[model samples]
Target: MSRRVVRQSKFRHVFGQAAKADQTYEDIRVSKVTWDSSFCAVNPKFLAIIVEAGGGGAFIVLPLIKTGRVDKNYPLVTGHTAPVLDIDWCPHNDNVIASASDDTTVMVWQIPDYTPVRNITEPVITLEGHSKRVGILSWHPTARNVLLSAGGDNVIIIWNVGTGEVLLSLDEMHPDVIHSVCWNSNGSLLATTCKDKTLRIIDPRKSQVVAERARPHEGARPLRAVFTADGKLLSTGFSRMILLRRLKELALASPPGDAESLGVVCCDCMPTAQGNNFEEPVALQEMDTSNGVLLPFYDPDSSIVYLCGKGDSSIRYFEITDEPPFVHYLNTFSSKEPQRGMGFMPKRGLDVSKCEIARFYKLHERKCEPIVMTVPRKSDLFQDDLYPDTPGPEPALEADEWIAGQDAEPVLISLKDGYVPPKHRELRVTKRNILDVRPPSSGPRRSQSASDAPLSQQHTLETLLEEMKALRERVQAQEERITALENMLCELVDGTD
Candidate 1:
């Protein structure tokens, strides 16, 4: 089931070098950063936005063209009433960026100008549905204007960005806060992870749950579940282990004639646990082994799956042995920090030799720095046309068609033909960045620089500054919300008073 095939950067250091095992350095300041796909509309140019965590509403839009001389102010995207929590670029539109925030709304902006072309602030759009804070927003992998957002209200709302309407609302499905939502490459399947220790797959069109895994992990706070390069599901949770399986496998495993049976496969994999110890009586000997939480990732070229253990900080690589039906562990990479979100470059024929490390950095603070690992672009697993193309996949073809039909000026692709090495210029990182935090149980003590404050401290400052600039708007929103709640409270008071 697995075959070997392959593949596949530079840097500037604003932070002084620390000279540790990994050439560790410190001092650069990055509030947030994300790894870009090699086919990223910007290509080779690592794209991400960084915010000043201390209270500034301004954000630095980075078009990291060259690692040696990264231009920080390429485009300063502004206009958020509060500190922005999440920022993502359109997979096919480099000039478009969407952000979710503590401002209780989501806004889509045209990059560079930071102009808000679309804003969801109406009572129904902002407050009527989600009673809690919105934590994340995810654009469909191949859909032009489709998006999915999960919030503190324990709901997932799929939105049609073009129409600015909620397509479907997934509520009462997850027992706890939903942390993340993602669409598979084909767009027919949507996966969600929740603090309820479950991962559910949904058919967004029908607004029904097709597949569900109960207690997918031992811990709550399921961080995220993502699709791999090969079109499998990887769920990561608080137990520090990622659950890996095939969507096809999951569907097939459902009851016959079940709605989930859409050519889905059935399978699963577990990370090997080391260090044998005393076994307690009455414990299932073979099954009671430590079920390390695995954050699954796929390497398309090698057709291998990497299981990152959040509990152990080690990556175990596996590959489907017989397609069964069988998956085999290949190799492993050990590191210090636990990885959060991970994905391979989406492109064909990428050179693997260029890949250096196992992960990338986002929102780093101390003088920004590129992740030591140079991830290779993920190649195509199956033929492009082989996938379920109901809603269509890949925007390139549609753009091409539009270009031919319309007399519009010649459209330029985000990436031109040529190989560009990954570079880092003006890279920023912070010692106390959230991504840099290692839980107390992770062992080593982390050192903090003067500006590297805890998230709580930064949150306090951000909240105060945000209240100052948008106090009127926020108070209005709160007053409306409180009025409704107060009416309910008054009714209760009258009933008891």
Candidate 2:
């Protein structure tokens, strides 16, 4: 007689619980833009969501503490001339956010701590290089002020937001639209999926595709890929399958078999020096047959990966291990209403005292709900096993250092005493003038014309002028206060005399 073996895992009993109704953000006008990008983004200090606007694109930024019904006329960060496709909060700075839009530009905004009375109509810096609408934005994992954007024109541009300059542009890699892009732990390599059914590992600094696997999934639908904690590639496609491959192996060997299997395929990209190749058999799991795409959010602390399907009312999480079944199913968090989009909070933002392992912001039709996942424990003491040193807001490397081929892991911070967000920090952008560079010896210098200035430059000038006017008003108010104080002092002295 054969006895069945049970899997022993700490996260096996983990459960997800939704916050109370009063804790949810209500009456939000979620955008109806028909795009694959997640409409919501959240950090420890604020929650941002793309909303429908009349003339152009806009997104509302609400303090995390403001939980009740949002005012319909709540001020928005509006500047994009078209619908905002994606927004990503900078990992190194909570107050900094980058947004991609249909206007073929990427704008970085500096969010203030206090809520603004009027809509913010200007961005700290606008990056314009893509010839088509930008659909994806991802910040460097360990570098400061470094951002990456993928556009519809089949181009990927790495930008240094500190100086508003293009660090590198990988325009020759993808022949079709890029579906998704993710950075590794050190931000030295990038894993991207494209519409041409290809998975590529790119080194932006080298401007080359180090490795690529064509048709990782034999489906017409788009594919999404991300870097695992161990520097492996985990990809999901519409063919109801997930593929895990080691990056080292991918760089050494070529994929041998066709990806026609309809289950989890673990390809051994790394082969031995003796030229021996071993392939793991496919493991199958029955998933929902809905057309909704699966968005996988991975937590490196717990080694848990949550799969949130668009337009689905359930979130399924799995634990990854080195055992036979690498991906083990934990449990599903179900709700009545389907989620339009989802925002995942970083590990540092979780409450360690409550044993909170992960938190998600689920976007509904008109509201946003918070779902907390915790590991039940009998003791109230800090669970060291549940909480590990996670990536904090401090950057490990600067943009220039990263561009110079330096790689560093993210700065880790302990959450044993609970994490406190830092005070509001400003993101300053210093733009370089093109006119400062002299003309080539073969070409004559031409007179600069105001009409020849780029729209972004003109906007920057207007923003500077506005700043000057505001400063003048502040000075005038100070002068008036001083004069009034002097008059009051003189009257008091006369009375005393």
Candidate 3:
């Protein structure tokens, strides 16, 4: 119940730390095994493997082909004594990646050589705060060198990556294991969903709870809560329940009595609205139940939440609206025919790209599985020239030249009116002939002029070169995206608990 304010110095430091996380990929490789779901990483030119369950971590690194195939032998990311639980690339440094493991430690590694840069042994700053196993770790979205870690002890800790310092520890709140911790867009608020069937909000800097509600999924299953793009409340929980719900402001239980405003009734003698006359109360209402869980991938581009059911392998997508209704069933890719631990590789249209899920990649019993989908790309769905009333490019434009030629001349014939204006007739004749005349010939056509021939050929060559340049750029972008998706798919395969 105690509320604390964050110091201004801490706020300035955290906010000023915002910068783009830089990732560079050079001399990196992907591991073999198309069907195996192993945790992976990529930044255009390189690929890194944190853990590969395939062949007992034997095929940890493979060379990624532009064709999306993995060729050649790759070594396991050495050093972790146990299976890595999660791996995250440093936002600004592609050379660095952070991983949490069952070994009760988090290690940050530099790619290529796969050397441990920071062991975080016993946690560089032991969140002695959490008495149980540390299960999850997430870096601040915009802040440089800031990380958030959650553990089995139902505690959350905020850390400074550069200094290896514990900035804040959040404990004594969640009743059960804290499944996840996410910061809002501005990093002012922290949203956590726990096994207690409640989603709680905290002001991270102050380490104090701003709001607490027991209205999340009721099954005691681990849940996830994330803020929407605008930092408004949007939470996913149980009972076919994904609630973008809000709490209502309550009316004060007791009416205040100002003695100055009271004419006759004495402050102590009036049948006062105090003590037993009133009771403190708090209530929450269930707005609506949204389906699916294991959290979801929030697509900021479309404002849609992609959710997969824990009970079944069904993937349901819902638009996060005023009440968040299920928009469509984004194709379901099932393993076990329909149940449990179904992982998803989140991207709107990645299933067809190189490294995309096709008939080629193989799937094993324990490895990660890939889900294929084809969604319209955001760029393709909208264009600057489009308006609601503007129809698509007019088909009639194709025959416009022919139509204009046929109607070019206006015939001026005699009008048998009682009164005919000579000037009017002349004006009509002049306008008609003006449009009917052929365009004046400037000179001999360029093809007939020999000296101009080289200029024409030069122009043609330049046009061809420009076209080729554009094509190369497009191909390169697609290749990079495919590499990124492959890495993401690998993580889905190997990092699952």
Q: 314-373 in candidate 2: lDDT tens per residue? A: 998888654434567799999999999999999888888788899999999899999999
For candidate 1, lDDT tens digit of each residue in 1-497? 99985311011111111113233223323444231111111223335443454443334444443233334333345555565666655554545556666555666654432322222232112212455656677766554555677767777876655545566787867778765677665466777766665667777666678777665444443345665444445554433234652111111122222322122222233222222111100011011123334444554334445554433435455443323323444445555544333323333212224333233232223333333333333453422221111221135333223212321211222222323432222211111235345456555546655235656577786788678859878876787688689889999999998
What is the full ranking by TM-score, best candidate first?
A: 2, 1, 3
lDDT tens per residue, model 3, 252-314: 111122121211112122222223111221111222233324445564434445555444444
Locate the minimum summed-lDDT window of 10 residues in model 3: 422-431
Candidate closest to the true structure, highest TM-score: 2
lDDT of all the models against the reference? 0.44, 0.82, 0.42
Model 1 Cα shift for residue 463 (angstroms): 38
TM-score to native of every candidate shown: 0.52, 0.83, 0.48
Local lDDT at 443 for model 2: 56
Q: By descending lDDT, how would the candidates be arranged? A: 2, 1, 3
The lDDT of model 1 is 0.44
Worst 10 residues of 1 by lDDT: 278-287
